[model samples]
Target: MSNKVIKEPSNQLEYIISSKQEHEYSKAVNKLFDLALTYIEDAEKGNRLGRKAAWTQGVFEAPLFYACDTVPISAIDLGRLSSRNSVQIAEEAFDLPKETCSMISVLLGEWVLRNNSSVKRVVAFNNACEPFNMAYELIREQGYDVFRVEGAIRPKLNHDGRLDQVIKFLSGELGDLAVWLTGKQLDESRMAREIARMNRILAKVRTVMELRLKNSLYIKSLPTMFILMGSGHYFGKPDEFEAVLDELIDELNSSDVIPSPLGKVIPLTWIGARGLEFGVYKAVDDCGGALLSWFTPNPYDRNWREDVPPLESMARYILDYFLVGSPVHQIKGIERMIEQSSSKGIFFYHYVGCAFGGVHVEIFRDYFKKRGIPSIGLDGCFQVGAPSGQLLTRVRAFIEMFS
Candidate 1:
């Protein structure tokens, strides 16, 4: 029997899997995902790292969303740039009072609930998200130095100057960590100048990457397979990441793949892993229904809360943009994502993994039923490929019956 909707997901798979041919499993797969854990363990050993973030030569000491998420652990030693963990790492490292920093950490804690382990230090934070911020405090109590990244989001990207400035400052200060982490030194002057440029490139490249993955060429490669892995780190050098991204672009241009479902193409919504990998076009084609998975899909996160950060930074836009008018912020993205389905049915996979998301899938199933969308959650492992074929059949059968 020939399955329909087999156009491979060349563009979207990169977000899920790191490289080409990632659908196939190899012995080294787990090694790729587990690398970040090693760093946290090494740091706990308290001997692998030097006091400073060695940033010389060509190393980029980046910030990560959390100390314990897959990015920090899977990306091991690759320059884990920590996000403010809902707040800046600097404020906590210096012993600032509980304020916004605590709130940030609360969100950070929530983000890390899936498996947080990489953060070595924390910054000052307020209690916005609650007990989550408390975890950072507990980490510091244990004698590890967790620094905070500072500033708040002004609702407008332009007003985020302070945040950007802090990023620049930290990029310089973490110079020592770069050498210690990447094992390379650089010309201080050259490194400093390149930092901003590198920063620019990251933004530019992400934009380019997003656009390219959505193009016509990627559509031809149907039913693509994605193997997921992360080094669990965020910062180091933009050049290296840019190189990986560039390589990805080149690969997508010259590859053949497949997608799922068929062109009755409905929107598919996935809430797991990071804000990458929702092969909307492919999923739409597979199910013969329209599909729309967020870059970082979460159910509870309905608006622009960083706790709600997705590939689309989808928080504000969904509430404001989608015009669905959600009362409980959680409804905007989650409901809207599935509501796009004219087929009145949806198949959701609550990934047992995390790069950037985790919201109650049960919530979706229940709520969508009320709205008449009929959302279903599929059980599976995290990051590794090859979900049960029986499960796939169930999904296909459900879609067929609906169609």
Candidate 2:
């Protein structure tokens, strides 16, 4: 990573998008770190434009920060800045249980010694799972203002009133948070504009995803996905982020980009959490395999209804996503991705200590087998690295059986 001082962007969205440059993500990650560090400094000087709001996980909307004049950040995004050695050492130093997620342990361990004096608040959705909820309590005890969002009950997209109710519920919570943080009411108009821009970004992401599936552009596309997932919470300005997405979409759609020729290698669909462990999937791609689909909360799933309220739009987006609600809802999403990408096998990269994903791995593995889709369940930490040596051997053997 570069030691360059990260400058606050004249245009925040442009700056954020620039920090997540594809093919040079290490530099981007460095820039993001510097950005966070800068924010901390500003907060200390009482010169900050917005209060800091961090999601416990990656599920929350980033636009909420803009509406409330808060800096959006996530531990998951910052996880990219953590070295495997650092996380491993932190885990050992903390003496975390063997069953704990190293990624969470790393954050907890590091936070203990670090000065996060700039952070004033933390927000988490309840649906993130049990382990994360426990982690949130620890974060609260560290003196940050912590708030919990009782996330929507698994509501179907087709259910008319359910989504409306969910939106109303979250909107109330967000409105309260904005007022409490900034001493101003939530600017519905600003949120509407931001949500509109988010919708555009979502469209571009969907386009990239479709192109990726059509051409097996997984290797080229994951960085862009990461950008979308991280940029919103990284103090991203909306208009610039949209422009960046447009450029990314153009690059992905270019004729020079050739599809992967992994002929017999079974392309896998990643379920559960996507860790910051870089190059894991690319290693598989290099070994005659390809990643067909990498799932995350789908922002584009919302109905871009002009008449609908922005809060409702965000609610619809959150509720309609593949990761929301029940195990059955997620299973449907997984099966759809598998079919859409023409994947021959499923890789349940179950994060250790994630109860939800761990339990689903067995169910989905059996379900995939029953449906004639070969499945492999691999266990590792959230910041876990690429499959190598023995793990790589197992992945290759799994591929060989079907190939």
Candidate 3:
């Protein structure tokens, strides 16, 4: 056997550390990093304090694991932090194609290298993409206890209680997943508590998003994305995460606004997958542009219903996600975000391997162009590196148009 190992990337922590020293929300950012480090270390050790640690396929499925007493660490989040070497290891080990989604490849690479051996269980869904489903199968073949949830695709034309039926089916599936994880029936009370806790964090995130629109200089683009995405699993510490959000909110609310380092801020809305490179956001910042909002299906943008049955409510939350609807619905969502953020342009970036997002770039670009709004689509892999010359040029040109 070839002796090789995939070590967890420290670049993410490095970025967070640098940001804490330079950014406005130092206290909260530091806390967030500490919490994330604790969780990652615990996960690598095979549990969170005492609960089972499971790799979760998507953010939406995290709450189910939380309620079922499992710590749901996001596999995609891990992939986002992966270094190029780690990705290569995954591709070679799994015989993954060059066209395989980078996120899936990175996670599989980490698993195959036994970098995250403590996470012996995987909670995956079928709704994300084909490669993700394939990853689930591969994980099972690797001797993992994998639980797959059947994701419901929202009907484009809802008629005759079709939406309700989808909700019911998905709820049942989630219920089954909950029981499978814990060998006990789904606990509605615990589910409600978890949902409530997440809702609090989401509400705070919404406030920060609003603040970003009003005070675009208060935070940077990459950190905004990080904060919003953290709502997915709360870095495996809900209480600490909440406190971090509170601290960040207070800082943003009280801090005096400062002029952009590059004068004349051009507000923009990012509409696709977040590139793993920090330079992607730095390029925008260098161009005197601020990404005020992102048009994506973020759980932080909405709340789960605490008044309803927890499983059914979770199902509704999934169905109600902006991405679950038709293209028209997604377009409308983008329009609302642009209007709210007063964005002068749209930055649509997608990984070359993300077929689902890549195909829609032109559709959205054309739709927004007709309305006289400028937009640009960039395609690249989610690898940790500096932005390409062409990428920087396009970003500079796009922002210069507004300038």
Candidate 4:
């Protein structure tokens, strides 16, 4: 055998959409990225906006395209910048929260700040809320221009009207320049595929640990050292995603099985609206945690279950959902995982200052605690920058406590 295991294809000339159980996604992010990739070749050939982003690189490329007189519309979703100048600049410019929005943005922010050299005017949107807005404030202050995209109504299933408005607003805001849409797509197929790839990758990683656990490499921990690239969007692309998934299989086959007694095994569930930050996921894993799955959608999220919009319907949905043993929201999943896993405690990384997440974290923590499940909450800008030693230190402590 040629030791060459082919995966899903990455050969589409334009953008590609892959499904997990294999459904088609043609909305919002999928459409936007498809549109962008349609122009990758032209961009790389050097358009007026300068180099259009080529698809052959790792994740999102820096020094992004900027046509003359047109500052591209971009979205940032991880990490943060810590500098006196940058911090002060953000405070003076907007009616923003200096204290709350400290130093955390998405992965794209850091990439743009470091790469796009000729970007004279830059605008960024912060739908992620709280610390994201705060982080934007700092980015604005630091000589890097950013605009905050206030959270509009988050749409539920059959709410194409809201998604339409979101897309329209983004397209409008993008203006005449080539728009850069970064982050997760709310496509069920794509999400499922991502979850599937994650499942496969984690299975490989867990295999080694399983061998150590049972002396037979039988049951594994799930994906541990997964490298789905491009802000973890590779998981969204059926082909490139499968590339990384296939890659993980090889890595698992060649590496040493982690011998146990593995102290404090952590099986986690992560949920972010667009998606969770991969950087935080990696750092958590580095500190000895197994991400069960980053479930961006709550069970009530139009994906796993139907989302009831109005309070009457929502309340009814909740009452009925739990009654049927299908926990309605994200909390239900956490509760279910703790009930199912071998983990000792739950760690909640509340996106440093995400408002919705802050509220959700508290809610989830409370729900789990009532069941006697221990959960730890941490503060930081997840992917916009390198996770400081402070984070690792905290994780170490958590793991030790697990032991």
* Number of the top-ranking candidate, with lDDT as the measure: 3
lDDT of 2 at 87: 58
Every model's TM-score: 0.41, 0.77, 0.91, 0.47
The alpha-carbon lDDT assigned to residue 25 of candidate 4 equals: 20
Model 1: worst 10 consecutive residues (lDDT sum): 223-232
lDDT of all predictions? 0.35, 0.58, 0.75, 0.38
lDDT of 3 at 47: 74
Model 1 TM-score (2 dp): 0.41
- After TM-score superposition, the amount by which residue 370's alpha carbon in candidate 2 deviates from its true location, in angstroms, is 1.9
Candidate 2: minimum summed lDDT over ten consecutive residues — where?
8-17
- Candidate 3 lDDT, 154-242, residue by residue in tens: 88766998988998899999989888889989988888888888787788998988877667866777678777667887777777788
Q: Cα deviation of 94 in candidate 4 (Å)?
A: 5.7
1 or 4: which has the higher TM-score? 4
What candidate 4 gets wrong by more than 4 Å, as runs, is 1-97, 103-127, 130-232, 235-242, 253-256, 260-289, 295-328, 333-341, 351-353, 381-394
Q: Which ten residues in a row have the lowest lDDT in candidate 3?
A: 1-10
Tens digits of per-residue lDDT, candidate 2, 1-403, equal: 2345554332223333434443352433344334443433343344244444544454456666677755565666555544456555555655557677766776765455453544546676776666667767876776756778777665656477766677788767766766765788878888887666665666765676676665554334245445546444533344544555565556556635444466544566766556443444444555666675766543333345446776666666666565566666666767677777788776777666766777766776777788887777777655533434566567677777766
Highest-TM-score candidate:
3
Clashing pairs in 3: 46-118
* TM-score of structure candidate 4: 0.47
Question: For every candidate structure, what is the RMSD over all alpha carbons to the true structure, in angstroms?
Answer: 12.4, 7.0, 5.7, 12.8
Residues 1-403 of candidate 1 have per-residue lDDT tens digits of: 1223343434332423332233232222223223323433443333234432311111112232221111222221221222324233434443445433232333333224323333443333221123334545665555545543222322223364653454344444344333434446434444334333434444533443343334322322121111111111222222344454454555555555334334233434444323122343233345554333432211222222233212112212222321112223355555554443223565555433321112445555566778766655655432222334566566666656656
Can you write out model 4's per-residue Cα lDDT over 1-403, one digit (the tens) per residue? 1224334322221102221111122122233234334332233234335632322121211112211112222232222112224333444444445444443323334433443443323444333344544545554555654433333433443275655565455433323222332332223343234334434533533333333232212112212212212222332233443444444344445545543345544555443332222344444544556655333322222221223222122222222321122223446554554444455677665555556566666666677778786667776553323456676577667766655
